[model samples]
Target: MTPRSVPHPRGVRLVEGGADVAVYTESAEAVEFCRFDSDGNEHRTRLDQRTGHTFHGFVPDVEVGTRYGLRVHGPWDPANGLRFNPNKLLLDPYATAVEGGYDWGQPVFGHDMNNPDQLDESDSAGSVPRCVVTDRHSFDWGDDRPPRTPLAETIVYETHVKGFTQRFPGIDESLRGTYAGLAQPAAIEYLTDLGVTAVELLPVHQFVQDSHLGEKGLRNYWGYNSIGFLAPHNEYAAGGDGGQQVDEFKALVKALHAAGLEVILDVVYNHTAEGNHMGPTLALKGIDNASYYRLVPDDRAHYFDTTGTGNSLNVGHPAALTLIMDSLRYWVTEMHVDGFRFDLATTLTRQGGDADVHSAFLDLVAQDPTLAPIKMIAEPWDTAGYQVGGFPAEWSEWNGKFRDDVRDFWRSADSVLGTVSQRILGSPDVYEPTRRSPLCSVNFITAHDGFTLADLTSYDQKHNEANGEDNNDGESDNRSSNNGAEGPTDDPEINDRRNRQRRNFLATLLLSAGVPMILGGDEMGRTQGGNNNAYCQDDEISWFDWDAADQGLQEFTRMLIRLRRREPALRPEWYRRGPRDRSTPDRVQILRSDAKGFDPPDWNNPTARTITFVFHHDDADSFALLLNAAENGVEFTVPKAPGQEWRLELSSDDAQRVEGKVTTLILEGRSFTLLRSVTRKDVRGWARAHGYEVSSKGKVPRQVQQAFDDAHR
Candidate 1:
């Protein structure tokens, strides 16, 4: 846990206890200490150059506002994640902030051979950019109360900082598309209105556009490739000196907190901006390639490449672990971030460069009280290894299975026998174990890397021609059915079906017991235009179009979220039976569509497409949610209770208002609805869901039909 800073030989010439901070250059041809002030003027930092290009020193006057850059003395090594050119300045990964967006040129490019094995060809770093010091943080938040909303009650809204605020008319146009923009009154109003408790911003860490992307006149829009864990991306800041980015980000966090919203950052620790072994080397590679990266143990030149991002962070190293831990703590204590959702988090669970599910990082997080209170979410998988349900207890994980099941269920026209019930009820099969609460599964259908919810139901295949990469990069197996069309359509039949499917999926997402994550702009029906891998487009293709807002979809989304909050049954934290369990033969009943006297309906019966859940809760009885995904509605009889008369509650058929405590007759085909009663009553504790027997090896028991039939009265 102690931070260990490795010494660079002849690096920084410590002048009387290192004035504030110092930079050491051991291997640049010529060293230059160009210092800039907050006003971008020529600020001076004294330099002491050791013979052989070691320009190491400190600026006596270099305090928080001191902005300085160092020119190093090494030939650029382009392929090994090191781009050390004595002439070109490099951004400090540890710098607190940065200002101004990057416009690529010879000054920013490395001159070493594109292949590291090849000799140097040109001087590429004469004018490369530099990061600066910052002291812009200002807040009087003493004993600031974090929202303290439990994981069970947290509904995360995964969004892009710029995209969320870019189109809002209320955010000042100048502040639009910046970190401060997210804290705008208009944006806060919208998020609060939607009942979102947390906002998970796509990676805010400083990053560089991929070289290939730059070659193609593209920019890294999503910000996944990180260069700075401690510093905020300069592009995201409205305006600042090189060091105020982090403070500005904290200001945004504070503003969000004021709105009762928690900010969970999307962190990418799996890899750096450095791509595979062939990437330009900056700090890690230059400092110690063998130490900072997870190199192939036996084959030093090669790497495991678990994350597609090339050079995976050598998380097994104590120094690397310390860096990550320190960064996380700083965000929590300094920035006041509510949580982190690690991208490609599985890579962190490897020790000694091998992917071990219960590695040291995972162990530390599981036991670290300081880090545990905040939300610890993992994407749960990477390209090389996907350990779904792999991390230790207390860590909520993104359930990819939840996404797939929900998508297939709504999009599946043919018989997907047991998908609807499984997904609608918190995906118990995936998260219910070892007392792991239902909220453990972060249920999300569409995320930043995919088509939006609207597009998922509209585009069966991706349309990524604009990427200019031959459309071969993104995923092809999208479990989407476009209602018999490729993209856009005018046919009312298919369009209506797509709209209804959207509503159903949204409702199911909010009502399900798991923690729901609404992909940003999904409520407004945002679309990637079928481009799933839009990492390289910082244009309109990746930006959320505010002019194209779907008011109806947004309102539909609002009602679904409101209903989820209103009904406690919809958000049960745990399904384990409790003392006040509502189970009674007189008041509660689970009847199969064609069964008599509470007998299990013939589940294998494809024709029997509808199952009526007849039950009651406090406030009223006679509540039923009839599900019929088939073409024709079937008349299923509900055995009359001796003293209880059935009154109409709500049905999916009534597109207007189909909720509350009331009774109803048969539900319609290809639809699901909920009904309620005027009088309070007890409901069935156990549902007619596919029951599981305790199978060996901690796996869910197969959905046995006989066990269900035995529950019949």
Candidate 2:
């Protein structure tokens, strides 16, 4: 029987007695499906059917563990952006599971290294990984349900699968550094105990290990360089990679969900592993260069790379958009992922050469039914431009301003008090004009790209020499301080200061009004030895040293997380400001250390190092936050509340309490304190007299508090 044509779903789908395969490539003159036997012998069959740009065919006896690849025959004119060689076997763009690693040399390059314009005609089948036809529905997801945690209450813990489990002693030896490792009871318990709602994992997409990093005896620990968007990275699977990687990843998601944790993937849809004109042809570049990538208008030979990864996906093209959308849907629907944090998302919105809010990519995502309900977050910037608040209203962004301003305030940078205040209140200046809520800002002090929390307080400068770039790579001007001594100092004073700074950052992040994303291992004081960019260091430098974890810091973080969860006022859904009228209970208020409302001059004061925030929520306890980032301790006069007394709750410095009717509180240098408002027993009598039901010995009801405010008003 002749192979029948089918073209609805893009990748290989198992049918009765056979399998149907399809690939989308508009420029390919011919497409051949090559299946490899156990002995590595290739059997080539040309796909004779075409529907629009999709080439498809059905092959008999194509079983579930079948290893296969594609060879697209096309024009080799490089100047006009056509560099496809039939000799180069490409992995399917919609591959669900890829089964090998790249050899990474001249054999894998589509064009000749010596002559860029000429095709190499070298067979890359031996060098590049082949796509495996997986039984996607085999996983037993018994009673699995997504946590679907509200974005406002989300506490994202950004972690790498390998790095998080590689050094964890809680799991077995074989399961370490694998998907199964993360699903173990110990891992789940740790996350649940820490109070994070979601685990925003670093890229699990099938990524190519960098050829250069390989030459230098290092691996891409971050896994940002994606080649197969749909497939889970095979190396991360404790099970074998033929088809087990898919099931292993699904199991991970199931386990996380069972533990009431959401899984948010850090996806790299901006670009593929293929670098540039001189880059390897492992996948998209070899399949169809012009259709998948954004090539320069004048010079088609080169790419218009905004991602700084040598190539950007052509979001303007339907094929590229379809692939991305398909990948996203597959992850959410098949893999059961809760959400996605798009890396360099701004590049995907550049449909017309500049990032547009209503770009095709964003519009597609907005209308996609499968993706609409899932949480979508954007890194919101690219190498070419910074678009922090540039994403559409439906999306939250990795607030770069929040990181910078918070760092500046803690490090005592001049004239940042106003900006830091804006950040702490959920960056209303950035998101309010767009009519977005406070949840639009995902507040974080340190991320995977920069210094870990421990290093942020211990290193004034980036020490990235171990990355082999001679300290030239990674960001400079980190707005970081070394306290008194740099890296691994024995000075108790300096160590104490660093520890205090970490607490301050954690407190500020959790207590602020927005989604909080803690860098993984930050609670336990993980460090990369000042290597701000540890993407390539997969060994001891990147893994969490559980034995050396700072247990004190971990407990402090847990306290902050618990406080954040217990108080709804800290994570508001909308932008809140001081009350417009006296009758309105103030949702938020900024004040001087003397308990006076901050004037315009005080906001702009360059030397201002101390500030106070008064927070009131209808459904939770009220709080007063005192922050002093100065070199000397400051005496803060607590704001007076008639029926409530200020009780010390949490402090970064030595704990101290105020006795009856005492309004003064002393905050140490570069420290923060959180005070809870305790209602006086007489307030219950006042509530009862006002005809409101009152509880005699517990916290006051919100209605009672509101009634008391109206009475005062």
Clashes of each: 31, 0
The TM-scores, one per candidate, come to: 0.81, 0.95
lDDT for 634 in candidate 2 is 95
Residue 707, model 1: lDDT of: 37
lDDT by residue (1-713, candidate 2, tens digit) is: 65566897998888877788888888889999999989999999888889988889887768889999999998898899988799998899888998989898889998888988888977888898889988888789999999989987889999999999998889998999999999999999999999999999999999989999999998998999999999999999999899899999999999999999999999999999999998988888878899999999999999999988899999999989999999999999999999999999999999989889999999999999999889999999999899998999999999999999999999988888899999999999999888888899999999999899999988889999999989999988559977987898988888988989999999999999889999999999999999999999998889999999999999999989988887777777776743233565668888899999888888788999999998877645678899999978999999875347666778889666655466888888899998877445546767888787876677888778767655642
lDDT of candidate 1 at residue 586, scale 0 to 100: 32
For residues 1-713, write the lDDT of model 1, one tens digit per residue. Answer: 21222233222222343343334333344445556655656544435534332244444555555555554445544344334554344555455665444444443434434544543434333334456555534555655667867887888999888877776788898988898888777888889999889999999887776767878888788998887787778887876545556666877887888888999999998888766655664455544455567876666666668887777888887656766876787688778898999999988987665567679888877777778789999988887777666666688899887888667665544444455455555665665655466777899988988788888878888888888889988888558767668777899877776776676667668766679999988888887888888878777877788888889888877877776666655566665332245463332344565534333335444444455544433343344455565655555554453222343333335443422222334544455665443221122212223333343333222343223223431
lDDT of each: 0.65, 0.89
Q: What is the Cα-based TM-score of model 1?
A: 0.81
